[model samples]
Target chain A: MSEPILDRPRPVAARRDAALPEPQAQDPDLELVDRWRDGDESAFASLVRRHHGRTFGLLVRMLGSREEAEDALQETFLNLHRHGHRFRREARFGTFVYRVAMNAALNRRRSLGRRRAQLERLASRQAAGDDLPQSPRGPEAGVVQGELRARVQREIQALSPNLRGPLVLYDLEGLPYGEIARVLELPEGTVKSRIHRARRALRERLIDLVSESDDESEGAGQ
Target chain B: MSLRLGHRRFRDQLSDYADGQLSPRLATRFERHLASCADCRKELGELRRMLELLHDLPAAEPGPGSVDALLRRMAETEARPRRWLSAWGAPVAAAAAGLAALLLVQDVSVSIGLPGSAVRPEARSASLVAAEARALPRRPAPPAPSTAAMLGRRAEFAPATPGAPSGASSSGRSALAACIGSRDTRDCIRYHWMLDLAGRDVPAFLEVFESLPEAARPRLAGDLADLARGSGSATAIADHLRASRDPRAATLAARFAAVGRR
Candidate 1:
């Protein structure tokens, strides 16, 4: 639970960008991709249906808006449908999916238009009198924690996309350094360095949290 | 100074060490450093705590049925023919662009060219200025129908001249679509759509031209190529259209014995 916190039943404020966890040894899902490449369109659909939740969960955190993430999701799979043939099978197909999904999220983010916040949407959801799925300590503690969480999100968003991409992939999505390197077309060492730099920047910005121990906070790591 | 640099290097490895990513030997060395360095221990504890908080953020789920919606869109897109201009090679696209540019220079429909601009906008008669206003794109933005589409739109807004072609109104809509924003193509396309007396009835005249008998394609192609230069013969090319199934082709046949299909 100190790592991936994906076991929630209700909507928690999700992090923005994430990727599917790729197997370090081999890509077992290459057969599914091969089936789609061989004109078994149903395999593609099954992949879309299966992976949509995880890909979208990551993108919403990455793009900072559910609506934009949804659009990015469509672009991701459509790109796969159109150009998945270009996938040389060098990396795990799961890793390839992450690359496409991440690229779509980043490209859509860079596209000349408005940027929206996931927190703003969550606030709207809250305004509708809907309680978030978890984080129930006390109302007073919840509000303060919520403000700190929003600040953390903004600081993460403010990081350069270069630092942000690797950090989100490694820390939030829980992809390994090697898989992240393949997805980002960077050296694994570069990916590790970027993640570390991103972490330091985030830590420096949220340094006040260092004084206040998170170990006592409700489900801080889980 | 050496100890300080060593401490700084250990701090750099702190991220790797906290993630339990370093090799065992490096980890042992880092452990040795951490045993004495209170600063490194405190920093590692803070880093671990921060990393945990980040990991604890909740997940964002997809809206209900987004996958189904995506699949439906995929099916719909597959059903339709692709719309990109990739089919036409660079040469044809270049030719089309050149034709579009040529028509732009001679744009008489909006009177931005010689005959139109001959009279200054300020000095033009009130009635003429009023007529031009309706045709000019001086208002807020419209949709992208693109550069050519905008031109076609402006052409519709243009005031019709006295003694203009007999079927100008009938061809206006088709001309609006076929204009590609060029007055020459608009005039050419509108003229063809105008009469049983002249051009074929295809809205996508270029597409229709592609479908014609190979012998006939070059005949019309020659006319179309020379169209910008104003040297094309519309009369001879109509003879090639006798086999065209369009009802309008009949009028073209009757006129083609005398007129060159320019």
Candidate 2:
């Protein structure tokens, strides 16, 4: 079990905009994409600069490691550069870029073998915790927050690709359902179904943490 | 709030309702259900708070100079004389090695080595459908016809389970598309080779099939089943096992691809 969520702790949810415009409606990213396709290297560079942080955020959440996310980020943009000519008007450049980022992440994760990376990260977190100095006062909210983040990441990593892919693209990355469906090659209905299914699964797994948090919140209020 | 009405309809839509993604009518119904069901209210509260917890995980930056580094790498890539060669050098080298390996493709010693090995649980997407395919009870391979074999066979070739749909229904092209669409290059290569051998050369297909470690058979069978399942094809011979599925392989060979028309 982990600490309950009291308020927002997100620092730079740089991936999620307050208002996400639909990909098909008045896409502003396409002009840059078109320019990049026209052999404007700067256009490509600009595109990377614009979306790299967002994609990096996604990769970290999906891959669960900064180093892995960094490598996948490079692979992603490089693939984009080499294959920018293949870009279609069917998707917003952001959507297309995300699809590429996700593909690279999935490929890299497979090469290293599935779940092994996240398991290593979790074990290392425990090892790091053990290495911390013992304190007189009961450990603290930060430790609880760290553990909760790790648990959430582990649970997310534990989900199968089909399920996790849509959920991350939707909830974590803040992608619209249509874009997620496009990215995953699934129908919109299937995407929503999978998202709900994934949420149900996650809620079940973290129910203990949720209960503990609820109890803590109640205790603190009292 | 009543506890006895079994208000799961509202319960099930909690996430959607929380997100305001539900239709107005549905949302109204949910609100009505919520007003009456204390359990639903508790559940929704927990669900919303959990969602907030998920959002509490931090998003991150690519660190300073990451974009520039990627650009520099791309620029360096562009600077190379043989850009295509440099880019594809690994796959090209692997193909050369594979070609070298192909000389020994007919080498029966290598082909028989892994027929009994266990499945490695290869790719992510294959696991879900493979499990389902694995559940179908396997039928024993009947004696093969004199001409067919997995490089090592006792003259028995059965058509998967009884009444397994034959090649007429399963098109290898669709399977190839689905496999490639999966974005697993190695599996794509396997499907490519398997499709080639299955359609054009039965003996070669058998040699390659028999050469596969025992573990790979079910997964391959399962992947093919999964692929077929995607295409809405009913004739998937997914239950073919490593040992007794030899007969199933014959039908699979016939069915792994029906034609090269694609």
Candidate 3:
């Protein structure tokens, strides 16, 4: 009644040592995977440090809400922990992890439909004369970097999943076309085409933003 | 003059040409075109500039404390003992340990000190042992069939019959295919079928689906559905469903399409 065989404490490190080997000597991901397999608690921690930001950033972009992104990020890591054995070196560790993050974010998006509907209702209410004050542009006012960034983000968000996958992998993650193709399970030609299409779409959306910024700069005589 | 004129076609290859993915001969032709054509040159310049601007987009950074959280999760996962030993580990050592444990358990259970009576003579009989061995046949069992193989076999055996509700036929194969095919019928069929098949052999199906004409989607969907229902093979439905525009029929066809090769 007190304990089950499955719950028996097998030898597992409760903490990772700070003096663990340098990240270079061992492939950090492989090491962490092996350590996790062997019940080294700290190895898992190192892995989280290595990949959390990139994973979080991807979830943020995918979900477009910081709170949702955080939740998705947690879910992604939990999935990784449960499915660590599925990792094989056939794909880059980063690509594999990002794929998991993308999937988790997509799942969250699917589940958030109800919340989206609520938000839409609120948005409709706001449209009917809510007097929310607009925040000023950043310190570099004339540059409109913040505005441009928002425009770019919106344009990217507007892209279809097909185009966005390659676009984000290349532009945000800095993965080469080959890596992007491998990660997305697409042909390199298709990856290139999608990236091109995404770029073209983005350019179309941002033309006004770009021109407006240019006009503003000229008007300011700077 | 014809050769010079034909060189203009190379101008359209600039995107691939720049990446050196183009054939050497075609690349050379494109370069020659680029040298002579001002408009092509300008277009390439614009493309290059646009690409440069895209590259200049800020690199996304990971959120704070996220890495630490990930590591802690990993550590927790690692610390948990696997229910079974992996093939990569020390097999002999594991086997020996397992054998020793088994023997210890047998010894403990059979000990005369236990409250239960010592081994009954009938329990130790050769016939009894043989009967038990026959029932349990402890040699490693054959591997289970993969999900794809099982599904394929099930699909093969299941008679192809229309399962959708009456009105669903109106919205069925042909209509669905028409909707899907109009935008990218081939890709739509491939994607839909792949999803229908739970994402097996996706790339191959995608290629084939993408190559088919949009007008042919409904027919394809109807045939695929029939195939799924095991009423017909892929080849049987190919011709009749090829250009079918009936949504219900197309949906039915797609329902049975070979989503994965297996």
Per-candidate DockQ versus the true complex? 0.13, 0.15, 0.08
Least well predicted 10-residue stretch by lDDT in candidate 1 chain B: B120-129
Q: Pick the candidate with the highest DockQ.
A: 2
In model 1 chain A, the worst 10-residue window by lDDT is: A4-13
Q: Each prediction's Cα lDDT score?
A: 0.54, 0.55, 0.46
- Interface RMSD for each of the candidates: 15.3, 14.3, 23.9
Per candidate, native contacts kept equal: 0.30, 0.29, 0.17
TM-score of 3: 0.44
Model 2 chain B, TM? 0.27
At residue B158, candidate 2 shows an lDDT of 20
How would you class the docking of model 2? incorrect
Candidate 1 lDDT by residue in tens digits, A119-170: 5545544532343223323325444556555555656675777998998888
B42-130 in candidate 2: lDDT tens per residue? 56666665687788878877777566555543433332223223333322222222321221222221232323223221111122112
- Specify the poorest-scoring 10-residue window by lDDT in model 3 chain A: A1-10
Summarize candidate 1's per-residue lDDT along B1-262 as a digit string, tens digits. Answer: 5999999999998887777666777877877777667667667766876876787676777777666666544432322222213443222232232222222323333433223333222122221222223323343442222323322332333213322221233333334334434545333532332221123223334343343455654455543433311322334335444556566445444444344433
- What global local distance difference test value does model 1 have? 0.54
Q: Rank the candidates by lDDT, best first.
A: 2, 1, 3
